[model samples]
Target: MPLSINSIAPDFKAHTTEGMIQFHDWLGDSWCVLFSHPKDFTPVCTTEIGSVAKVKDEFDRRGVKLIGLSVDPVAEHMRWAGDILAATGQSPNFPMIGDPDLRIAKLFGMLPEDATGDSASRTAMDNATARTLFIIGPDKKIKLTVSYPMTTGRNFDEVLRVIDSLQLTARHQLATPANWISGEDVVIVPSVSDETARQRFPGGWESPVPYLRLVGMPS
Candidate 1:
C-alpha cells in the first residue's frame, strides 16, 4: 500500500546534491517537507523548485526542513540548480536526492516494486507517479502527502499553511476548520469533551452547535 498519513516515512540512505545521507538521520527530529518531481530540467518542476527557494526562510522559521527529489542523478541535479537560480534569482540549496536507480522511488512506492531502468532510460511519463509531497513530523511519521499531475503546478504557500496547522494541532488538542489560517479560531478536537475543553481552554469557546466548539489558538 502507498504510505499513509501517520505512517512511518520509510528511511533510506541515498545520494543527494549535498552529499550522501541516511533519511532519518538527516531529518534529525526536525519536521520535514520532502517533495518530488517526475524528472529534472522539466519546465513545471523547475518553476516549482524555484518558488520553494524563495520561501525557504518561511520554512526555516517554522523549524521545517525542505528537500526535493527527481529521478535524475545528483550530477544532473547540480547542473539543473544553475538553471533554477538563473531563472528564479534564488538557488534551491536544499539537498535533492538522485534516484538514478529508482531505489528511492520504489521505496516510497512512487514506482512499481518491479520497475526497471536508470534515469537515462526512463521518460518523465514512466516515472510520473514520482510527483508527490510528504510532510514528515518530528516523530518520523508522515503528517501529510500530496501528489500532483504532470500538467499542474503545486501551490507551496498552501503547503506552508497546512504545516502551520499541523504543528499547532500537534502542540494543542485542536483542529483547524475549512479555510483556516494562523491566528484564526480552531475547533476543539471531538475527543476532547466540553468539560475537558474548559480546563484546557479555560477562556471558553464558541459553540455554534453543541458538537462544534471553536476557540482562539492557545498560547
Candidate 2:
C-alpha cells in the first residue's frame, strides 16, 4: 500500500554514504526530503545529485534534512561521491542510504512490487528506484511523494518551492493556492456553512465560483 499522509513515516536502519543511520533516531526533529535514484554514476542521477548539492544550504535554512536512497552498495556510494565532487566541486553533506537489499525502500513503499515483481528495478519507469521524491514532516508523516521516469531530470525549483510552501503552511494555519508560490497570497480553508464562513472569515468571503472561496492575506 502507498504510504499515507499524517501517519508515522516508516522507520529503518540502513547503510549510508556517511555510515549507518537509524531513520527516526537520525532524522531527529527536522523535516526530511528523502529521494531515490535508479543507480549510482548514471547521467540523470548525477545531474540530480549535483543540483541538490548546490542548494544544500537552502534546505538547511528551512530545517529540512535531506537523505538519498538507492539499491546500490556503500562502496558504490563512496565512488559516486567522489565523482559528484569532481564534477560539481562540492561534496554531499547529506546521507545517501546504501539500500543494496532494498530494506529501507520496502519500508517507505518505494518499491513497486507488481510492476517489477518486488524490488525496485533499474529498467522500470514509474516503479522501482527510478527517481522517487518524498517530503516527510518533522512529525514523521509523509506530506508528499513524487515519482519520475529515469530519463528525465527532476524540477529542482519545484522541490524547493513546495518545501517552502509546506513549511510556511505548517507554521501558520494557511493553505497554498494552485501553482501557489512564496510571497503569493494564500487561501484560507473555508467553512461549509454561510454563517460559519461569516464567523470564521469576518473580512468577508468572495466566491468567484461556488466551491472557490478566496481570502487574500499574508501567510
Candidate 3:
C-alpha cells in the first residue's frame, strides 16, 4: 500500500547532487519536503524542479528542508541540472537525489516493489507513478502527500500554502477553514473544551454554533 498521511516516512540513504544523505538524518529536527519526478531532463519536470529552486529560501525560513528525487543516476542528474539552469537561469538550490535503482521510490510506495532498472535501460513511462510530493514533520511522520500525472506540473506555491497551514495548526489548537490563508480566522480543534478554550483565548471567540468557535490567528 502507498504511504499515507500520519504514517512514519520511511528512511533511506541515496546519492544526491550535493552528496549522500540518509533521509531521517538529513531531516534532523526540521520539517522536510521530499519530491520526486519520473526521470531526469523531462520538460515538465524541468520546470517543476526550477520552480522549487526559486522558492527554496521561503521553505528554509519556515524550517523546512527541500529534497528531490528522480529515477535517473547522479551523472544524468548533473547533466539535467545544466539544462535546468540554462532554461530557468536559476541554479537548483537544493539536492536532487539520484535514485537509479528506484530504492527511494519503492520505499515511499511511489512504485511497485517489483519495479527495477537504472535510468539508462528504463524510460520515463516505466516509472510514471513516481511523480509525487511528500511533506514530513519533525516527528518523522508524513504530514501531507500529493501525486501528479506526468503531464500535470506540480504546484509549489500550493505546497507552500499547505506548509503554512501545517506549521500553524501544529503550533496552535485550531484548524484552518476552507480557503484559509495566514492571518485569517481559524476554527477551534474539536478536542479543545469550552473551558479550555476560555483559558487559551481569554478574549473569547465568535461561535456560530457551540462547537464552531472561530478565533483570530494565535499570537
What residue runs in model 3 are displaced by over 4 Å at the alpha carbon?
Answer: none
Task: Identify the runs in model 2 with alpha carbons over 4 angstroms from their true place.
Answer: 112-130, 192-206, 217-219
TM-score order, best first, reads 1, 3, 2
Q: Which stretches of candidate 1 lie over 4 Å from their true place?
A: none
Predictions in order: lDDT: 0.92, 0.76, 0.90
Instruction: Count backbone clashes in candidate 2.
Output: 0
Better of 2 and 3 by TM-score: 3
When superposed on Cα atoms, how far off is each prediction in RMSD?
Answer: 0.9, 3.4, 1.1
Is candidate 1 or 2 superior in lDDT?
Answer: 1
Provide the lDDT at 196 for model 2: 69
Residue-wise C-alpha lDDT for candidate 3, range 115-210, written one tens digit per residue: 766678888999999998999999999999989999999888899889999999998888999988888999999999999999999999998887
- For residue 33, model 3's alpha carbon misses the true position, in angstroms, by 0.1
Evaluated with TM-score, which candidate comes out highest? 1
| Model 3: ten consecutive residues of lowest lDDT | 114-123
Positional deviation of 94 in candidate 3, in angstroms? 0.6
Residue 176's C-alpha lDDT in candidate 3? 90
Candidate 2 C-alpha lDDT tens digits along 51-118: 89899898998888999886678788888988888877777778898866655676677665443332
